[model samples]
Structure formats: C-alpha cells, structure tokens
Target: MANKTLVPQAKAGLNKFKMEAAKEVGVNLTDGYNGDLTSRQNGSVGGQMVKKMVEQYENNL
Candidate 1:
C-alpha cells in the first residue's frame, strides 16, 4: 500500500500526533518498522488516534 499524503509537509506532524496517541495508550511504539507489535496493540493505537482527532474536531466546533 502506498502511504501517500496530500500535504507532504504534514507527514511529520501526523507522525508526531501518532506517537503522542501511542504514548497515551501506553503503547511502546517506536519509530520505523513496528512489525514486532501485535495486531491488537497496533489497532489500539490507531483507534486512540481517531478518537483523539474526533474529540479535537468536536471541541473546535
């Protein structure tokens, strides 16, 4: 799959946000490949990210 972002400059910002979410969820997520992690753990991180994004958006409404 291609990890293409429309705003290339926002890639770093997105990564930073992902890292923050991982930390909040107690996920020892590292930079680069994380194939060592279990699917459940990875899914939790992604879910947490989306939850946070939605909260932020709602708050700004």
Candidate 2:
C-alpha cells in the first residue's frame, strides 16, 4: 500500500490564522510549494497561528 499526502489549496477564503502563525514563527509561506514542509513544521506554524488569533479574540471580548 502507498500513503497519500494532502496538499493545501487556496479556496474562496484565506486561512488567515495559518498565515499569521507562519509569520510569527518566521516561516516563509509565500509560494505554492508548501507541500515540501513536513507535517510537523506545517502543524507548528498553523497551531501557533491559531493560538495567537484565539488569544487576541479573547482579549477583545
């Protein structure tokens, strides 16, 4: 059996949270070949981004 990998795509809306997180962690996500990123790397950027966004939303409430 072979493993399949999922690729990220730009849809109608942007994943603002992920983009912000990547910026915070100094990951350059400006291009389309982000699939080269390992799962861990990708997850870290995404996770941090979501965390920051949530914190901001909470502070505003």
Candidate 3:
C-alpha cells in the first residue's frame, strides 16, 4: 500500500505544522504556493519545524 501512492494522508498535518512553524518564526506562508520566500526565510521555517519536533521527542522521553 505504501508504494502505490506518493502522498500520504499526513500531508495536511505536515502543512499545518509548517504554517505554524513559519508563523512562530515570523515567516509568511500561503496555503497553496510559497515560491516568493527567500532561501533564508524558507530555511528558517524548516529549521523551526525540526527544532520543535526534536523538543517534542525529548519531552516524550
């Protein structure tokens, strides 16, 4: 079942999480596309997401 499709149902959840992380870092992100953002801005959003994920994992431990 996993190899049949590329996108999983968790896509929406990830998108929501990305938006939240972007907001926390003061980066503006739209619902559809985000090609207007610079490298640093995009990178910051990803970094923030990873940071939060790590924190969550640590808290669970």
Worst 10 residues of 1 by lDDT: 1-10
Give each prediction's root-mean-square deviation over alpha carbons: 1.0, 5.9, 4.0
In the predicted model 3, the residue pairs found to clash are none
Q: lDDT value for candidate 3?
A: 0.92
Instruction: Choose 1 or 3, whichever is better by TM-score.
Output: 1
Give the Cα lDDT of each candidate.
0.94, 0.71, 0.92
List the candidates' TM-scores in order: 0.91, 0.58, 0.85
Is 2 or 3 the stronger prediction by lDDT? 3
What tens-digit string does per-residue lDDT give for candidate 3 at 1-61?
4534256887888889999999999999999788999999999999999999999999999
Which candidate leads in TM-score? Answer: 1
Q: Supply candidate 2's per-residue lDDT for 36.
A: 74
Decoy 2 TM-score against native:
0.58
Please give the ranking of all candidate structures by lDDT, highest first, separated by commas.
1, 3, 2
**Comparing 1 and 2 on lDDT, the stronger one:** 1
lDDT of 3 at 22: 98
Pairs clashing in candidate 2?
A: none
Q: Candidate 1: which pairs clash?
A: none
lDDT per residue, candidate 2, 1-61, as tens digits? 6643244464313456566678888777764678777788787897896787689899999
